[model samples]
Target: MSSEAEGRFHIVDVSSLTSVHRRMPRRVTLRTDDGVRIEAVYEPSRASVTDTAVVLAHGFTGSVDRPAVRRAARAFAERGASVVTFSFRGHGGSGGLSTVGDREVLDLSAAVRWARELGHARVATVGFSMGGSVVLRHAALEAGTVDAVAAVSAPARWYYRGTAPMRRLHWVVTRPGGRLVGRYGLRTRIDRRAWDPVPLSPVEAVPLIAPVPLLIVHGDRDAYFPLDHPRSLAAAGGDAAELWLEPGMGHAENAADAELLARLGDWLVGG
Candidate 1:
């Protein structure tokens, strides 16, 4: 990184980003309410912007610095919506271990605050996969923090070990040895503790998020939670929410194409 480029990065704490790719967004460090350090990037909107800030939540083991996350930010930025992307605790350059979907609401809430601090009057969130679940919970629990929320490829209910991918995921979070694989191989840290009382499931969280607009997006071919999860979320959300069942879309941020993001961006800034 050039000296001039280095000036753009904002160091919020002693922790810093280890690397930066070509044309990285403006970086800022954040601390979650639970004292977890979070790494986030801010991408300003292009011409014809609608003055709405869109905060993106990545899936399990994903960070704001990843290529796919950056690409998705660009997609939204190109649509004239300022975007914020962040890694949940235990992921990327952030501190702490993953609580999976639980406790991630603090991280999303922190990012949303950062977006508002950047001067955007309206805010929206679009989360993918595990991230998809986080946004729903955040909107429900926080309330009035965001104008709209979208959950893509999110499971409506929790503890769903039905799918092969989910079963494997359960193993990663539930087993001691699997945590090693997550830490060493995937660069993700898993929390060993289980959900004691269990948090509100996405389906249950959906109704509470209204009259905050909600959007549920899913792929017919998703390998994770399947179509029924999205259907359940849509059903729970009722008329205040919109559902999009993409034919070819697969799962999460990696599966999301530019066109789908553009449409989502439009919907977010519409209200």
Candidate 2:
């Protein structure tokens, strides 16, 4: 634990951006409809000039301070967009237990609402893995919630336990012992209850997000969800969606490279 704390100094590498101007992020606490306290941070663009803000949602077992998320946030900031990174309930300092992707929509909704309250005219919600699925559902459930949305490495449907990683994830999500490990070892709290009526699927939610810019980014070599998931989402999105099947990429936030993140940031801000 001591060693882990020592290596946890987060470094934001935005040295490439000219006229780099970083503002210390304002930490915030938000509440979900279900009464959970969401831990969040608002990172103003290093350029300090932008009306657009991007809300970043991390993957399963990931927090706002995760290196990949931090790197992505910095990259987005360098591109001149303010960023809001938050920990979903059960992750990091957020309250409540994880519902996996079931009730996580409320968590994303809270973050999105917070971003809007920060006085940004345009807000884009960018999510990875489980967060990816949450954003899709949030967009569908809450109309006019955001201007643009990006889902990276999301699953189209639920209950998919095909890949080895996913199979292991199922063990983590469905079993009591796994929840214990999640609580103690991973610092994640898994909810003991089950989804009463499994929430809307990502494919089902895509069509409803019409007129909003939607970018579905999936890695071709992803070991968790396959190409079929993103393809289904794109099909359901009709003309409102753009799909980027990245080559050589693996999965989620950690697998997302800096180049891909920079492009995503640009797209979010309409650059």
lDDT of 1: 0.83
lDDT of each: 0.83, 0.84
lDDT of 2 by residue, 14-77 (tens): 2222223224576756767676777777789885588898999899999988899999999999
Q: Which tens-of-lDDT digit does each residue in 201-262 have in candidate 1? A: 98999999989988999999899988899999999999998899999889898998888988
**Clashes in model 1: which pairs?**
none
Q: Which ten residues in a row have the lowest lDDT in candidate 2?
A: 1-10
Best by lDDT: 2
Q: How many times do residue backbones clash in model 2?
A: 1
